[model samples]
Target: MTAASRPKSVYPLGAKAVRILVADDHLVYRIGIRNLLGSEPGFDVVGEAADGLQAVELYRKLRPDVLLLDLRMPHKNGVEVVRAIRQEHQTARILVVTSYQTEEEVFQVLQAGAQGYVVKDVGRETLIEAIRAVNAGTRWVPPAIQKQFSDRVLRQELTAREIEVLRLLTRGLTNREIANVYGISANTVKNHLNNLMAKLDVADRTEAVSFCLARGIVKPEEI
Candidate 1:
């Protein structure tokens, strides 16, 4: 929601190198992804993008077997990028990699045709296995998100911190500003926003704010 944040198959079973495109706005994170996937035996890192716009362009040009997408990028965001890519190519196997574990975030991309939803802090096995599962035609929703899909997730309420983040977000404070207010990292601010989005069942901050306002979660004077 604020900021945060792959691969492919076969030849894993001994076929061809599974081609992949890694897309994230952070150069360091992108490089880390490349290094990890590149080290794997059958995974091939083909192309990379620093923003959602470039990601779409690169995806069109390369058409890799798998696209490792970050949820919150500058130009398009992962959800938009997923929708765009799918509109162009329906069979695109997109593995969404992000720090946001929100139900709405995960469900949004998967419903838009993402093949998998993986948290950024996942271990090597989980990451690699998720990539393989998606490439193999499985819709991978790990335990973290799978549990959130239950009835209880829908009934869940937002935390005080999440409400604070949502209020600031609607007030036009950037993630960094929110982070400063909370004395936390920008990434943590994003995580809080993501949690708010999930609890509120909204896609982005604006939607969350609107829902909150309409539902009386925040007073009009507050905004």
Candidate 2:
């Protein structure tokens, strides 16, 4: 018989199913994932969360074997949620399933304690494999994402103040305005810009903003 036609009992007897928690803002995607995983014999989606807050709450309540999380969500982004869950439960296993595949986003979530990262465009088999791997206590970042994460790690990281300046720069704010916002001098703001630009390897504020946006360092909505 074909794989799709195979019975659910095809797996070896006594194999325990992997419990999963699906967390995403979209209703349709959640349902789709539920149905897809439901069809698999060795997977059981125990709970669903519509937002990051709900995701954390559900994880606390359900304590599933694996958490399938979305990178972007309301109330708390994936990174914050991962940090929160991992803070309380160090053994938590989280797999980020997001539409975004930017190096910065992948690195941030993984650094925050997620075990794996996969884009939503992946095939069903790949997604299932990621969940199983995470459930088995293995990191599941794809080779391309791993390379991107490594590249981001090798680069000089920006300071918190520099990141704030970059966010303001994306809004077309003048150096003087940014300085006033922070109660600092425009010359001080200029120094921050110079430092950030050098670290980012960009020529000017415009290029810096573009680079940040493209790499998911600073989101467009933050501007």
Candidate 3:
């Protein structure tokens, strides 16, 4: 049998299974996730959706315990689907599972009502943990992302220039481009970035952006 024909296992255990719906445009990836999740002891793969629209439809129809959403898809994207679901079901428990790990994207999903966010590159163990945490009325943002959120809430020591630099960073602009945009020297941009990182208590640009979004310093739609 070919890889495509491999069997997909479903786990049936005594624990109250967390019903799940997987949404992604890629057929193989969706199926792979179903197989992986199905093999877990307390997860039920209730449905699969190939796009955001379909995901929303399935969410309404199945009301699964968790909605595993992919950020990019044909005919609406994850953000749209999340909004649609939340509008109809205020108590929705959505988890964004996507390939893009940028702070801007992560922040947008959470603001849209996602209980947790996990990057596609995350290990299977971390992925499972995130799902469990979200299902248990808890949250699971990366530590770096969490720090950004916390700093933003307290309006910590970030200076005006640092905020500008951080906002530009969320836009995914290069250091040189940011400098040009602000009429500053490249070295000056680097210095601002260093200070921003220090003030945010983060070690890198990604974390800073995530922090900014988590704290509402930068709106996701603006990115």
Q: Each prediction's TM-score against the native?
A: 0.62, 0.67, 0.64
lDDT of each: 0.82, 0.89, 0.82
lDDT of 2 by residue, 103-191 (tens): 67888898999999999999877887888889889999999898778657634488889989999998899999999999999999999
lDDT of 1 at 60: 98
| Candidate 2 wrongly placed segments (more than 4 Å) | 1-10, 157-223
RMSD of 2: 7.8
Using lDDT as the yardstick, the better of models 1 and 3 is 1
**Which residue pairs come into collision in candidate 1?**
11-15
Model 3: per-residue Cα lDDT at residue 107:
62
**lDDT tens readout by residue for model 1, 1-223:** 1112133333536578779999998899988888887767788899999999999999999999999999999979999999999999999999999987676777677768898898899987688888888888898887757755543343346677777787787788999998998899999988888877877678888887787776556757876
Estimate the lDDT of model 1.
0.82
Scanning candidate 3 in windows of ten residues, the lowest lDDT window is 2-11
List pairs with backbone clashes in candidate 2: none
Any idea how many clashes model 2 has?
Answer: 0
Runs off by more than 4 Å, candidate 3: 1-13, 148-223
The TM-score, computed over Cα atoms with residue i paired to residue i, of candidate 3 is: 0.64
- Residue 98, model 1: lDDT of 90
The per-candidate count of clashes, in order, stands at: 1, 0, 1
